[model samples]
Target: MNQANFDEARKAEANYHNELYSDHEILEPGTWMSKPVPIVMELLERILQHKDHVTVLDLGCGAGRNTIPLAVRLKGTNSRVVGIDLLEEAIEKLRENSNKYDVADVIEARKGDAEQVDILEDAYDYIAACGCLEHVSSEEAFIKVLERMKMGTRLGGIHCITMNTDIQEVERETGRALETLIELNLPTEKAFSILEEVYDGWNVLDRKTTLLSIDEEKYEKPSQFRCQSITFAVQKI
Candidate 1:
């Protein structure tokens, strides 16, 4: 994408999320924010087995869908889940939801681009980026973010990433294809290849790709979206 197109895409995405967060309540049924990603919860269970205190970074953590639950799980321990998002409304809702969930004390919510967020070396026990990498500016930026995530993780730590690949969208009424505004929309195989290349020496605890379809309204029009969803979990050796 050119600079202008990239900026437009980012703005659209930010506006979409801002409106979504403002309109919906946290954990409201029939929404993607209704529950934390299962893989993230599963990996947290594994992390708790061997460690008492943990630190986690949740990229693109919209409205504390995963961050709040992770904090609740790690309650009573010296653990924290730092959540970052590009939308201001998301961060506000995340704070409110964290308070409502009684996990505010353990959550650090920040508004920032996931691609540009700082990930200090050996800083996190777990890192999660769910449904977010496609919002990055480019494939190069995506890979750079992954490298930062890898370096930020502590040894024996876990990373769970879920992203949409090979996305297709169409107008529901006319059956005409619509442009997908995401920045890093790679094919499933290509995305996996990049993951494998970046995490070459890490232990692959889980990896899978599944096709999914969803009907929704976007840009005030009904649309259908299909994509290969990739779920990857790895442990740093």
Candidate 2:
């Protein structure tokens, strides 16, 4: 993606996250808001059940959207959660939420690109990358992240990841843009297809694809782009 598009995505992500967390409503099933609740609950429950106090690393943890809720639940545990994001603004929002929620001590938020998160490697018990990795410059770079993550995680750890799936309905513009990118060698299908190689040693605990509409009501304006979010979970065995 071009710098302008990249910047726009960052802005959109920040705006979306800010709105989602600042709201006080509990999302219920059968609604667009319910999309993340289930996955977050599953992640929270699994992390809490681990025998060892976890050292977590959340990749592309935009604006603490997932970090804060997860941190709130892990409050009493010995676990430590670190959220890392590529956008500086997203990091700022995370810090703001930490103070707003007063859980700064338990949740540490940092600004850095996950594609090169070298500071913490082979050091995490659970690593999560939600809706990330697809935007990497190249497929090889995307695969390289998993290799680094392996070195950073302990044996028998878990890696939870989510990304845009190959199957989706898109607006004419978005579809055209994606096709151009693919033609130029930015193979999103090829990129995510390598997940099998990246998590070769892990046990596939969850693997499913869900098709859902992007809640147009949730957005500030209507657009041609629609999306399908894919989620997968694996345990290092």
- What TM-score goes with each of the models? 0.97, 0.75
Candidate 1 residues 42-139, lDDT tens each?
Answer: 99999989999999999999988888889999888989899998888889999999889898889999989877888899999999999989889888
Q: Which ten residues in a row have the lowest lDDT in candidate 2?
A: 177-186
lDDT of 2 at 190: 56
Residue-wise lDDT of candidate 2 within 111-168, one digit each (tens)?
A: 8876777745568877788766755655667778878877788766777877765533
What ranges in model 1 sit over 4 Å off? none
For each candidate, the alpha-carbon lDDT, in order, equals 0.89, 0.64
Query: How many Å off is the CA of 237 in candidate 1?
Result: 0.6
Please report the candidate that would top TM-score against the real structure. Answer: 1
Clashing pairs in 2: 121-152, 122-151, 122-152, 122-153, 123-152
Say which candidate scores most in lDDT.
1
* All-Cα superposition RMSD per candidate: 1.1, 4.7
